[model samples]
Target: MTDTDVLVVGGGPVGLGAAVEARRAGLEVVVVEPRAGTIDKACGEGLMPGALRLLQGWDVDPPGRPIAGIRYCSGETAVSHRFVGPAGRGVRRTALHEALRRRAAELGVVTVTGRVDDVEVLTSRGTVRAAGVEARWLLACDGLHSTVRRRLGLDVDPDRPAAADARRGTDDRRRYGLRHHVGVAPWTDLVEVHWTPTAEVYVTPVADDVVGIAVLGPRGTDLDAAVAASPALARRVADAPVVSTTRGAGPLRQRSHRRAAGPVRLVGDASGYVDALTGEGLRVGWAQARAAVATLDDPEAYERAWRAATRDYRVLTAGLVRWATSPARPLVVPVARRAPRVFAGVVERLAR
Candidate 1:
């Protein structure tokens, strides 16, 4: 089989990031993804300032509208924060994926379409037989419920059955996300997060005449119902035509026992995920992508970097999710209204 220095499984944004970074590092890279063309997902569609910078650094510029800040609203009470630095972009997920894919291609990263199977990690190198080739190092960016992570046995406790853990982790409150695009001129240059008792709906302007609305809530949560619950959001989209079909994803959480095992390294949602409440997944995923490639020779260092890169996302998301589901859920808007500075600080910090 043909060999390469780095083999990336999954060709979403983070996977493309890893491939691009590896190619820039003067290493031969090959990416195996089952899908072709632009990829789309149920996401907020708002790239934070930091994430935009990372994309710019990679020389992958996707077309979209600029978002200057974030606004949190519930009924009449509202809190907002304007990022002090460069504004972020609200590009469609397909646009972002295509941009990365093009950049990787320009950088000489080979793309092969197929599922990765039979991963074998040896003392000298890790090899995966896929796409009619083999590679020395494997970067698993396959996403939450990564096949590579499972094949490498990095997803569960050795003594406990995975089936049991998955069953035990099941809860009635498991969250999910749904997104749809509507044709309407955005009223604000801010990413608006409209919160309700049971869900949070994010409105991001990805084009001058198009805005994407993504609803995040527990299982069985209805997107239309969630939008109806928010008077402001419902009013805004009442007359707008939906430009895209509704898309969905989640239980919204995935856990990995480790970041690296032998010659394999996990990045992006494949690594581990808390929740999407804070809109920090792409930013954190970008950071992990850089770290995974940079520390390929030292898995320990990659683990440390992974922890450092995700520290804020994990802590803040968990705290907010806990509060969102707690008895005080109804108090969120009031708290933000009363503690404007506190709310703004948190928003601005994560907006990067």
Candidate 2:
């Protein structure tokens, strides 16, 4: 028996973004999350330059972390690329979520802990209603397998459905990895991306006291084998002590339709999420969150814009995956190494 202008169904970063946006629009907001503890999600903790810009627009000051560039290495060759015009910051997922949660509270958005029992879209009243909450608008920032989405009868596209599917009756393997926090990093200013024939290693300095590192790929893909693939880099990590363990990653596909249901907007993974291999989910999510907020007066307009952003990312990331795992990789490497601009342009064109 609580009410607000908009009720958000998740307490993650994107959910917080929606709640904050509603408050800015002069609307009362309530967020319902099943869990009350600090949010910990399976994510690689780095913000793209675009996401950083959006945060600044929201008056959000991202925690300062030094990131000069991203380093990618293969068999015997390594190519380093910097974020061209704008710099990117790396913040741990936990820190980022906590920051957003606190910010939402300060903005006067009510966040309550409860799994949504259901969402009853009231077409006649022109408002979406949900468990313990009612609002003119209801946003589903509630991750994949969203209760809001399910109540509306929207189905996810079957990409890595087994691994990424949020259905109740599925048994898919979730990838797990080790992430250790360290005050020191090999390159303090670079978000290093190292590669093996079988796996990819990503290192982002998210805070002064911690560097976020994740080793992820196919489920059966062995980390030891991947590390051995990169002899020099593997030795560096192998010698270092392990500190933390983060779990679950796989190919999360983009759901087809932009709008989840009538008057119920979906943002972030709830709208659509691409495979994490490209490392652009949070960036894309933030961009859509802001755009969705902007078109609050017209949710359909926001849905169209959000759909385009997702299509752009999916096309770009899919192409990269193909090339990275292609037979012509030998040729692709030299070209990308010598002319990053060309590579960047193509990917940016598809993704942006």
Candidate 3:
């Protein structure tokens, strides 16, 4: 077997970032992913200021439209917040992936294209083995519904009573996301979140002339229906050409019993995910990647670091998601409108 210091499963942004970090630490790394090229996913496409800083540190910068801040709208009530430190960016998923991939390649991170079906090989030996390579540590950065998380028995079944009790209603409301790009000039610098009764439609400017629209709600939530419900949103995109096909991802909530199992450590969504409502996935995942590599020798330390890294995202996102799904959902925008400072504080916190 080919020996290496680390093996990263999945080649998405998080996985690639982990590989880059490991290599920078003087560790030989190999990444195994089934996908051949830069991957794309359904996401809000906004990179918080913090996340952009992290990418820049790694010398991986993807070009995109500047995002001043966030705006929330519900009927006639609207509230906006400008980031205090730096502006964020709305980059297409593929562009971000390509940037990360290029950075990894620059670091001499070897990527093998194949699915890892045998989880035993990952945790059986002191040196994890898979995809014809052996490594001292395995980091699973796979996205939600990760096979690595499941096969290693790190996944927590939200349906189980014990899990439900521990997670406190994580499985109660399952939400999914759908995204598509439209060929229209961005009208606003701030990311607009149009809230409807059943779903929230996020409009992000990803390019000079391309805007990405994403819908988040129940499983059957229709993108067109959500847009149509918002007269303001509909008017903006009604005549715009659809630039990309609809992409989707779902049942966004995922939980892990623990982040580490033997030499295998779960990173990014594979470790656990609260919800994407806060638009903090990339930031949180990038932080987890750094933590995972830094604490490779001590799984417990990594666990602590992981928790610390994701604490804000978990608490704030979980609370917001709970409120968004509850009967008080209608009050969200109004509350923000009334409490502008609170809204700005929350937005700045997330942006940071």
Candidate 4:
């Protein structure tokens, strides 16, 4: 069996980032992923300023359009808040994946094209084994609905009555996301979030000539219908050619009882995810990756760090998701419009 100091499951952006962090810490890392090429996902594709800074620190800068701020719109009401620090970037998922993959490669991280069906944690020996590879620590970055988490008995059932109450009813109604790209010039520098009664459409400028549209709502949301609900958004992309096949991800809410079990630590979405309502997935995942690698030797410390790192995201995103799915959903835009400073404050907090 191959040997390494750390083994990362899944080769998505967060998995690659975890591998990079381990390599930076002078540890040999191996990443196992079933997918063979650059990985893409159904995401909003807007990296907040904090996330951009983290990638820049790793010298992995992917090309994309600059995102100046965020705009919330519903009917005729609209409100926006520009980031005060470095501008965020709206990058294609594949582009971001390639950049992180390159960085991990440069650091001598090995990638295996396979899946880890079984993981064995040797607590006494301080090692973990999975898929013919042995490592001192195993990082489960496999993402929401992670098999690693489930196998380790860390998965929490959000549908349970107790769990539902703990989540503030965010899981009462499951939501999913669908993303696609269109070959149309972006009309705005800001990421525009158009609110609908049943769903929300995110418009992000990934390239000068391409815009990404993502819809989040109950399962089986029609991407076309969601965009059509927003007249202004519908008109902008009415004649544009669709550039990418639709990618989907779902049951947006996932939970893990804890971040660590024996020698394995769940990083990124594998740990737990509330929702993507605030567009904080990448930023929060990156943070968890860093924390996971930093506290590899101390599972308890890693658990604390993971909780601290995700607290804000868990709180804000869950609260927003609850509000968005509630009966007062239509008031979202108007409330933001009326309370401009409050909206700006929230945006600024998230941007950081």
Highest TM-score model number: 4
Clashes of 4: 0
RMSD of each: 3.1, 4.6, 2.0, 1.7
What lDDT would candidate 4 get against the real structure? 0.90
Clashes of each: 0, 1, 0, 0
lDDT of 3 by residue, 165-247 (tens): 34765444478999999999999999999999989999999999999999999889999999998998999898999989899
Reference-based lDDT, residue 126, model 1: 42
TM-score of each: 0.93, 0.85, 0.96, 0.97
Against the true structure, candidate 1 has what lDDT? 0.87
Model 3 regions lying over 4 Å from their true place: 121-125, 160-171
Backbone clash tally (model 2): 1
Q: Write the per-residue lDDT of candidate 4 for residues 132-241, one digit (tens) a residue.
A: 89888899999888989988889987555445555665444378999999999999999999998899999999999999999999987999999999998999999999
Candidate number with the higher lDDT (3 or 4): 4
The TM-score of candidate 3 is: 0.96
Give me candidate 2's TM-score against the actual structure. 0.85
Poorest 10 consecutive residues by lDDT, candidate 3: 164-173
Candidates 1 and 3 compared: the better one by lDDT is 3
Query: What count of clashes does model 1 give?
Result: 0
Angstrom error of the Cα, residue 17, model 1: value is 0.8
Over 4 Å off, model 2: 157-186, 222-225, 329-332, 344-352
Residue range 1-352, candidate 2, lDDT tens digits: 3366788888888888878877888889899988886777666677777676666666776585856566667767766666556677788777777788878889898888888868887788777777667777788888766666666767554444444234634322233343444444544567666666645777788766566667666567654565667776666666555445645544454463556466688888777654666678777777777677677668678877887767767776766655555555455556678888875665344232
Candidate 1 has which clashing residue pairs, if any? none
